[model samples]
Each structure stands twice: as structure tokens, then as C-alpha cells.
Target: MNYQAPLRDMRFVWHEMFDVTGHCQHLGLDLDRDTLDGILEEAGRFTAEVIAPLNRNSDEQGCQLLGTEVSTPDGFREAYRQYVDNGWASMTGPMAYGGQGLPQMASACVHEMLMAASLSFRIYSGLTEGAVLAVHRHGSEALRQTWLGKMVSGEWTGTMCLTEPQAGTDLALLRTRAQPQADGSYLITGNKIFISGGEQDLTDNTIHLVLARLPDAPAGVKGISLFLVPKILTDGRRNELSCGALEHKMGIKGASTCVMNFDGAQGWLVGEPNQGLSCMFTMMNDARFQVGLQGLGIAEAAFQGGLAYARERLQSRSLTGAVAPDKVADPIIVHPDVRRMLLTQKSLTEGCRMLGAYTARQLDLEHGAPDPEDRRAAMRRAALLIPIVKGFFTDVGQEVASLGVQLYGGHGYIREWGMEQLMRDSRITQLYEGTNGIQALDLVRRKLMGDGGAELHALVEELSQHVEAAGHQPRLQEMAGAVSQRLEEWRALGKTIIEACQRDPQEIGAVSVDFLAYSAYVLLAGLWLQAAVRAGETLTDGTGESAFYQAKLQTADFYWRRVLPRASAHREALLGGANCLMAMPASDFSC
Candidate 1:
């Protein structure tokens, strides 16, 4: 079977778990349940019908560099045109720019479907969304007038050009230059590597948000400025920039990763001079969160594929008894080990979707919440979750995809099965959008320290209330208690890390990944327990979705009993201090 869009589960998370309907209603979106349902169902059909079939072929054919331009694989450009014509591109764009003015949550659900269908195709649109956001938020009025409409309408696509040959994560060594011109435009001259869709046949123009330095500027990141250099200039002539080459990659090859050379490309400034990092960061958060969805999407696809294969592949009888008496051996689903792997995938993919929806909700509130303090609180919480959403999801995503491979045994390792493609594609999500390590350090330094952990405390308090709400129900009491205990431990660990950071700064990087993993587990524990709460409430209230709710409760039990205990190792490891890591000399490691 082809990949279904998980529309039912999307509704469960959006309408029931989070109540995005009411939230959007409050924001005057007027997006009713039936309307939202129609939107999702339609999008589901499109992705399953149009995008799903292209995955295997797209991988094989990939994108090709022809002369000075990059050509996407077969059907990519056509599908993208259909995607744009159907108004999918402007789902969450600015209303002023002829967009639908929907909440980010709505767009996020759609994106999850797209990512599951074709991550390669989704990459192109995801970059455009980020570029639109950067331009809408920080671009000057004139720049906005010139660019936003075209981008929102899908007449053009966009890219954020930041990385160079020498600079990957460190912006301090960036050498891209922007020379001031007499006519108020700047000449952007630089080389950017791994530019996704740097040159593509998808659109008439590409609006590249390039990060470069001015002639008279500071020597580090502070001096960097964001500039808009169109592939085709305002007068409709091709700009000086060209696609020098494309990277040969292990996966996501259908998406162009070009070596973009900007040769005195005419451009205009965005945001304040020397504040490019700050501006790009604002866009990066969106990009990273979207990458997190990519992780979730790939995991969902793997789970679907693995589950389908498990149901059909006969291997051995159940340990208890023969499940298929007529057959020589029972289907693999009957085996405990197979069930364990499938269950783990189900739990993580579904649990991460819940977490993703929650994060998206917070993001919507950050943008659309009317109250100032409400928006601020949502902003803080969203900032905290971005790394988790990007780092933890992708990390586990790889694990889940690998489990899918394991489910298939030897057949999974080869090309024909398509399970290994997910494993390869999922790997990049963790590496890019700031490696999971970078996300860990970011969570430690920025979100943790920004307001002295006020947001963390707020989250803890909210989880505490949910724990209390689940107190009286006998079925939920144990799970609630487990989550409650984790909440306390999570809070204590944060305090410990902050104190340790005061003593040694390297302590932050050393414990960062562990802490992130710990928090990811604890956060999912809270969300899972809360999902159980909702499920149980629905069950008791005679909502009649017994199987769905029961499965949710069972999964919550698995997460609490089987998965969450792993956080203990992370906690102890982080508490062990940085000495274990810092004591090792760099040169001695190679020996």
C-alpha cells in the first residue's frame, strides 16, 4: 500500500489533543472543524496520489547539473507547479501578500504530509517558506513590495545563502562581500556551498537571502548582513550568480544541493546592517522546526512501510501459539521481537507527532496570540522546543527508520525495498539545520540562559497541573506519577546544569546532548501522559472511539514503562560533569 497521510491522527492531535480549532477561532481564522477536515483530506489525497509515487524514482534519477543551471529530477517541476497552483505554497504566508493567512499549525500539518510524501520535494518549498518569513518579518517595505507577492504566489522560490567553503556553523570566518553601489543596490560576491535549489527549473526567479559582509564592517558574525539577490533581477534579466556544481550525496539527491557562486550579484539589504545573524536566526528557527517535521515524516513513512511488511511477511509462529494455523509459519507480526520493534516505531512516531503538534501550537500562539504576555510566553516555550523538535526528533527518527530496516532483515539493506532510503534521508535531518550537537549547545546557551529558565519553569508547572488532572483516574495514576517524578527530576537537573555552567563553561557543551535527550524523554513523558488523559476522558465520556483511545493509553504505558527509563542514563551521564570529555586531548584521540 502507498503511504496514507495519517489524516485521522492529524485530527486527533490538532482538534482533540491541542484544540487548534478554538485557537484559530480566537485568532479570527474562522477555520471550523469541517473546513479544516476538508483541507487535510484534500491535502492527504494530493500527497498520496501525486507525491508518493515519485519517491523511489526521484531518488534514482536525482537532480542533474546541466551547463550553468541545475535540473530537478523528472516530475518534480510539474508536481511543484501543481503544488503552487493549488495554493499550498501560501498556506501560512502574510495576508498582505495574497496568502491564506492560516496559522502555522495548519501549514505544519500540511508540511508533515508533504515531508512524508517526498522530503526532496518538500525541501524546495520549505526553503521558500523560510525565505518568505524572513522577507515578511525583516525586509524593508520596498523590498517586501517587490518580493513578497511573487514568493507567496509561488511565481518565485527562495533560499537563505549563509554557508561558505570555510564556514559551516561558525559565522565568524565568513568572507562573502557586499559592495555598496551608487544606485542604492549592493554587489554581492561570494560562494555558498550546499545551496538547496540554488538553481532549479521550478520557478522563473530564485530570491536568495545571502549573508555577507560590507566593506567597512566588523571582523566577525556581528558584521554579517542579509541581502536579497534575485536569480533573475527586477528587470527580468538573469543575474550574475550561477550554479557552479552540485554535491553528490547519499540521499535527498532529488533536491539540488548546489555550489552557488554570486558574481557581483546586484542586491538590496534586509533588516539592520550588521544584524544578519540575528535576522537569519529568526528564519533558522522556522527552518529547524520544519526539519524536525521532516524527521517525524520519515519516521511515519518507515513505520507505515515496516508495519505493512510485518503483517504480510511470514517467518515463525508466535511464542505462545500458532497465529496462522493454515500456513507453515505465522506472519512476522505475531513474533514478540517484531511486535516490539513495530510498537516502538508506533510509539515514537505517534508520540513525536503529539509533540510536534504541541510545538506548532506554541509557534502559532507566538505569532497570532493577541495578548502581549501570552505571545511572549509562547515565544519562550517555542524557542526552547525548537532544538528538541529539530534534534531529538531527527535523532530518534534515524533510530525508527533503522528499525524499519531491521524489520525487513537483509532485504531492507538494498535499493528495491525502499526502507533504506528513509534511513539515509533521515540521517541528514540530524546533520543539517545545525547538527543535533549544535542544537544541544544552542538549547544550553540560548534558551536555557535567556530568561534564567523562566520558560522551563513554566513548562514544568504546566506539566505538574496535567499530572494533577490525571491523579484521580485509577488507570492513569501510575503513568501520571511517573511523569510527575520525571518533571521534578527534569527541573532539578536544569538547576544542576546551570550551577555547573557557572563553574566551567565547557560543562555546557559537554552535558548539552545528554541534557537534551533527558529533556526530550521527560517532555514526551508529559505529553504521552497527557495524551492518555485525553484518551481516557474520551473513553469515559462515551465518545465511542474506543480502539483509538485504548491504543493511545497502551502506547503511553509503553513510553512510561519501556522508553522513558532511558532518561536515567542521560541524567547520570550529564551529572558526571565535563571532566570525562574535557580531559581527553584532541591530538591524542587520533592516536
Candidate 2:
């Protein structure tokens, strides 16, 4: 099934659940409820109509590369043109640089739609936002003057060039070099692999943010520096960089993942020397979170497709009895097992949307909160949530996609129905934007234990208040109780691990993924309780949206009673310690 944007669900998360307009107002933005609603509505319409139609075709044709030039799949170029023409690229950018300067949450809402519609097409415009933000936050005035406007307007797309022939995640092994020259520009020579959108036909030029080292710099990651290398110079002369090859991958085939070779390319520096990792991180963080949005979008699309198929496909009668006696057999949706798969997809999809939107609100707070301390607190909160958003959301997204395939049986295994494409596309999100394992390590070792668990403590404190209050309410008591227990379990488990890590350095690594998963369940359960409460409010207040609110409450009930139990298993695994894993001798293991 072709994708359809879940507008009502999105509105529930953005407006009803969080009151995002109020959040925007507090961020000091002029965006009101009407304007935000219109923006989301338009974004929904655009993606459903223009972008979704091209997804299957794009995957089949993939990207084209000839003589160092890469062209997108057939309809992608036109769709991208419409995307830029609609001012989508600059909606979330800084107004001082020719953008609308809307709240980040507004952009998150739109981005979720774009990502859901066509992730492959979205790849072309996606990196531009992060690149624009990195330059705005850290680049010099002249650099900003030259690049910001065009990029914000979607005239030039961007790429992050950190991967090389030898270096993957280990930047210390990077060998790309930049030679300083008299004109104040450096000559960059290097080859980067797995560079998405390294070269594309959609934009006028491609701006690459490359990581390289100068002659006098130090060793390892400390010596690395960030550079801006454009494909075409201001006067329209082509630079020395070219797309050496395009990777033929399993999925997201529509995106041009390339091997780019830079031969003494014209370049300028971004941020200080020997601080490239730090600077690129600004771009990376934006990318990481957006990748999580990618996961959310893909999951939503997969669920929609799967749910639709389940309702129509007839099979054996229900175990209890035939729901459709007139037919030879009932729809597969009548089966309890089928209901299980669909509910799993639904609960996870809805929970992740809340998770994505919740994190976006913190980001809005980080950028716009009036008080300095409030902004810092929001930053810490966002930092803690980022890894969960990146890691856990993508993990569940893949699970949902796989279930979508399962729902269709043999039909899902093939390319025709498009379910397999969803599965293939969803696979990449967990691997890229720093693998989910890396995300877990960052969550546990860095965000959780790094600050002595301060960030997570703040998160627990905030979520606790709502959960504890809900426990006293009549209808919310059971859901609240389940979530409240998990919240404490998470806090205690974290405390135990932090104390153990002081004695054993590798202690954190052993259970980091498990801990991250555990934390994610707790966080999701907390958000479900919040949503359930709001749905109860709507029902009590008689909004006349009883069916919608009831469905939401039922999903929340499923999450708490069913999904949240996964946290207990993770906690047990976390407490199992590092010994069993570490005891295996390196030399003894053989396949």
C-alpha cells in the first residue's frame, strides 16, 4: 500500500498531547495554533500526494552515476523541486539567514511527514538543515554570507564526510589532509565513503562538510578539523571533487551513497583547528535526532500498510468463531495472532511518535527558553533522550517493519507489494547515524554515568511527578502504577551499575545496550501514561472525539500491561554483570 500521512495521530501528539503551540509561544516564537496546524496539514498533503507515489519506483530504478555525476531516480528530481519550491527546506532555519525561523518542533512535525513519505528523496534535503545549523552556530561571518542563504533555500544540498577507506567510527585513523594556502583557503585531498547525497542532480551544487587534518596538527581525533568544500565555486567553476562511485545497496537505493574523491579541492575552515569532531558533532547531533525521525516515519508507513492489508486479506476463520459468516473465510484480522502483530505495530508506532515529539520539544526549549538555566537543563535533557531516540526508536522501527512483512506472509517477501521495501529501508536506520549499540554506549557510559547520572536523574524526576499523580486518579491507576514501578526500577538499576563501574571500567559496556533498552521502555511507559491522561481529559470534557480518545487509551493500556514488561528482562540482563562476556579468552574463540 502507498503511504498515507497520519494527520489525526500527528495532531494528537503535537497539539492535544503536548500543546506545542503553547510550547512555541514560550519559546518566544510568533507561531500560533492556526499557523502550526496549517503547516502540518500542508506538509501532510504534500508528502502523501507528491512524494509517496515515487517511493517504489525510486527503489527499483535506484540512483544513476555517470562520469562523476549522480542523478536521482526518475520522479525524485521533480519532487525535490516541489519540496524546495514549497519552502520546506528553510522552514526550520534561522530567519536572519533567509529562513522562517519557526520552532524546531514545527520542523519535527513536518520532517516526520517528509521522512514517512519518501526517505530516499528526503535524504537530498535532510542533510542541508544540519549543515545550515552547523554553519550558523559555528561558522565565520564571511563563510555564513557565502553559504547559508543558498543552503537554507534548498538551492545547495549538504553531506557529512567523515568515513574514509580505512576509518569507520575511529576518527583517529583518518588520513584526509588539508594544506593551508596564501589565499586563506585550504586545498583538501581525500576520499570519503558512504557519503549520502555526495553528488545529486536536484540541487545547483553540493556542499560537503569534510573532516581532515592540517600539517601541524596533533595526532588522533584531536588533530581533526572541519572544512566546507563546494562542488561548484561562486563563479560556477567545478571544484576538484567528483563522485568516484555510487554504492549499490540493499535498501534506500534511491539515495546516492557515494565514494567521493577530493583532489586539492577549494575549501574553507569551519570552527577552530583540532576541533573538527566537536564542530561536526553539531551536525551529527542534528543528524542523529533526524535519523530517529526517519525511523519514526518508516515505522508509521509500515504500520499503515500492514494494518490496511490485514483488514482486507481473507483467511481462516477466527479461533472463537467466524466473524464474516457470509464469506468462505474471515479476514486475517479476525485471528488473535494477527491482532497481536497489528497491536504490536500500533503501540510501538504511537509510542515512538510521542518519543520523537517529546524530544523535539526539549530541543525547542534548548534553543528558546528565556532563562539560561532552563536552557541548559533542556540541553541536558535532550542529550539524554537523543541516544534513546536514535537507538531504541530505530530498533523498534525495524521490528515493526518486519512484522509488517509477517502480516503479508509470502506477499511481503517480494518487491511487488512494497512491504519488503519498507523492511529494507528500515534496516539502514539502526545501522547508520552511529549504530544502535554505539547509541546505547553513549546513553549508558556518557549520558547516564558521565555526569554521575545527573541528566537521567532530572529526566526521572520530571516523569515521576506525572506518573505518581496519575496513580491517584481513578481510571489511570493501573497504567500509572505499572509505569511508576518501572521508573524506580530504572533508577535503582542505574545506581547499581554506576557504583559497579568505579571498580570495573568495562562494567558499563557489558550492559549498556540492555540499560538503554530498559530506559527506553520506562520512558515510553511514562509517555503512554501522559497520553492516556490526556485522552481521559478529552473524554471527560466531551470533545465529541470519543472513539479516537478511546483507541488512544486502549493503546496506552496495551503498552503498560504488555510492552513495558520487556524492561524487566533487560534489567535482569543488566544485572548479570560483565564476567560471562569478558571471561571468554580472545584466542580461544573460533567459528
Candidate 3:
């Protein structure tokens, strides 16, 4: 089954939730309504016609591994060429670096389309953009002059190498060594694993932002430094690096996740010594949202595929007179249970899309807004939403993708249907870019508790104002109230946990993930409520946009009715205390 782009839903989010035209005006961008519409139309066409066709083939053909060389599946190189030619890569880069200088919100539209069409192909470009941002912010002029232009044009690619086999989540444990040389270059030697697009034939050279340790660096995370190790050494010219081997993974088989062996590889240091963590962190928050969108994209793909199949596939007749009495049976969608499943997928996908895009817009405001106070406020709001976008989206993504497979029955499990592949590709989103578990812990421990829950309180209070304003619209009022109530519960619960953690350090970890998940549900619901208000107004007019707006409002209701209610379980788990987690004895179940 082929997945179609949900351009209508995307447009609704852009116009109703984000108000793209007004936002562009705020940014000093002079785009009119027609221009924004044209951009989305073109993006939809490119993804559906150009990128979607390559997804299955890339999965089937997979990446090729030959000795120390790796080749991506056919058409990837050409697709990338077309992508850069279309100026998509430059959309979010700096204007000084040959970029289009578009806001990140506009870039989110392109990102959603490409991600929904083909994640593996887009991963290469996504990583390069992230790496370029880091370099542009911190690299020396000579470094920027030499590489930024081509990277912005997609002539070369980039990767972030921070994870090693033993140092998966703990960056401090990394053993990759970077020894400084007399010429200001360093020699990096270590094995970096799970490096996506690390070694591929799509580009002329790959630039790696590597995290390694200097000889006299301090211990733990503060000691790590970042280096720029290109696959080709250019002393102002030369190519000198070898691919080690590509990892065989469950999905995204087309993306070459390679184990790179750098043996005295020529490298230039980035940022100051022992400050690499801060340097590489320039892109972490944004990268986390991208991974979250991966989950959203895959979930949307699965939901669309399942909805299409359910509307047509016939199985058993209805208890009442069949709507399809002429046929042997009624459509599977007639069943209440099946309707529930489809609604769940639809609710989660559409809702998560709003959450991700709104978060993107917040990031845009944080960076591009004229007012310093507004920028700081936007940054704080973004901090509050990032974990939700990452954790809640991934959790729902897995559930929705799995439900899509279930909807297809046996056919879904089969490779030809591609349902199973969607599940596989989405699973990693939960694990990497800081696992959902880690994200949750960060929320409860760092973001929420470090300031004595001051940020959390401020966010809740800000949303409360919106809830108060929404009282006139019954649907919006109820949704906002539900979200507000949950936030209150979460706030009280967070306070209790934070106070308990002061007495027992281990208590924090045990309840962190559950607390994070619960908070995310409430956060997404807040965003959904905000969108529903506008969507409700548009649909009330009974115009062409009415159907689209009505659907958005209904999806918001679906989330409240089905998904938001699940937070009760998480709240229960969190308040249950950390006993079960801490009770497991070290020798109890030794393998």
C-alpha cells in the first residue's frame, strides 16, 4: 500500500494553528497567502511524486557494503541533488551562508513532507543541517569560509559522532582520543558506532563533528572536546579516510549506520578544549524535535495506510442491515472496535503534528523574534515542550504504527504491506536523540526540579490564561479545562516527587519516565486545544475550509476522549513511588 501526503491536514495546521502569514509578516518576510500556499503545494508534490517512490526501493535494495566503501540505494544521490537544487536544504540555514533565510516554521513543512515520504533519505540532509548549524555558530572564520557554503548547498554531508559502544548515553565515558599536533590539527583515533550516514556514496566527502578527549582534559563530561574530521583531508586539499563497516539494522536499512574507525585521522578542533559538549549541544534541542517528528511521520504514514485499507476491506456483515448488503460482508470500518483503532491513530498523528510544528514555531521565535523578552519566553516554552514532542510522540507513534499492522490482520505483518517497516523505523526514535526515558528524567530532574519547578509553574500559568480566554467556545473550553486540570495534577505530583528526591536520590529515576509521559500528554492536549479554537471558528462558517476545520476539531476531541484519559495510569504509576524499581536486588535475576 502506498502512503499519500495528508496535505490538507498539514495546511490546516499551518493556517489555523500557526497562522503562517501573520507569522511571516512578524518576521519581516513579505510572503502573501498565495506564496505560502504555493510553497506547500510544491513541497507536497515533490514528496509524494519524487521522494515516496524511493522509500520502498531503498528499503528493499538497502545500502551496499564493499570492503571499506559504502553505497546508498539507487536514486538517493539524484534525489539529494534535486533536493538541494530545489533550495530545501538552505531554507533554514543563515542568509549569509547562501541560505534562503526562511523561518524554521516554514522549514517544518518541508521537513514533515520529506520525513513522511522517506526518512532514510532525509536523515542525511537533516544531520548535515544540524552539523552546519553547530559549525556556523562556533567555528573559526577560516573553517566557515572553507566548508559552510558547500554544506549549505548539499555538495557535502555531515554527521555527529558522540556515541561509542560503551558510552551510549553517558558521554563522559567516551574513549575517542584527539591528540593535538604542532600545526593546530589533531589526530583522532577511536571506534564510533551507530553513526547514521557516516559512510555513503551520495556525497563527495562527509564532515564528522566528533567528540573526543584531549590529553590534559579534566574527567567526566566537562573534559570532552569536539573535532571536525572530514573523510577527505584538505590541507587546503586531499582525501584520506576509510569506511570501516555498516551496521545491519531492523529498519531504515537504506541509511548507512556505520561503525567508523578513525586511525590518526586528520582533524580540526571545534570550540575550546574540554568544551565540546556545549559546542555539540547547539543542535541537541532541535535534533530531539526532528527525531520526534520522525515518530510523527511514521505514525502518520501508518495511520493513512490503515485508514485507506479499513474503508475498503470487507470481512464480516454488520449486526444491523449491512450498508454493503449487496456484498458478502460490510467494510471492516463498520465495526466499533476498528473505528476506535482508526480514531486512535488519526487522533495521535494529527495531534502530534500540531505539537511538533508549534514547537518548531516556538524555536523560530526564540531565535528570530525582535524582542529579547519574547525570545527568552519562547525559549523557555520550547524547553517545556521538547520532552513532550520527543517522548509523547514516540510513544503514540509506536502504538499507532502497531495498530495499523493489527488493522491489516495477516497482510500487515507481510513485507509487501510495509506496515512492519514503519514500526521498525519508528522504534529507534524512542531510543536515540536521548531516549524517551532519558528525556523524561531530564524533564523531572533538570528542567522541572532544578529551578524548584519554577519553569513548570510559569508554563502552566501561561496556558491557564489561554484556558481562561477560551471559555466562550464550549469545545475549546472543555479541552482546555481538561488540559489545565491535568497540569495541576502534574504540578502537584512534580512537587511531591521533587521534595521526595531531596530525601531519597533514587526516587527521581524511578518515577521520571511516567511523569514525563503524563506531562507530555497534557502538553500536546494544550496545543491541540489551542488549535481547536481556531479550527472550531473556521468550521462554524460552513465554507470549503469548514470540513478541514471540523476534522481538526474532531481529532482534538478524539485525543481527549481516548488518549488523554490514559494519563491516569501514568499518574497512578508515578504516585506509586519508586519502590518497585529500587527493590530489584542485584543478584536476584542474574542471567
* lDDT top scorer: 1
> Which sections of candidate 3 miss by over 4 Å?
235-240, 475-480
Report the C-alpha displacement of residue 483, candidate 2, in angstroms.
Answer: 1.0
Better of 2 and 3 by lDDT: 2
How far does residue 206 in candidate 2 sit from its true spot (Å)? 0.6
What is the C-alpha local distance difference test score of each model? 0.91, 0.89, 0.84
Off by over 4 Å in 2: none
- Show the lowest summed lDDT stretch of 10 residues, model 2: 464-473
Mind giving the per-residue lDDT tens digits that candidate 1 earns over 299-340? 999999999999999897788899899999988998878988
- How do all models score by TM-score? 0.99, 0.99, 0.96
Candidate 2 per-residue lDDT over residues 32-55, each given as its tens digit? 888888998898889999999999
- Candidate 2, residue 496: Cα displacement in angstroms equals 0.8
Q: Give a tens-digit lDDT track for model 3, residues 152-211.
A: 878888999989989999998999998989999999989899998899988888999999
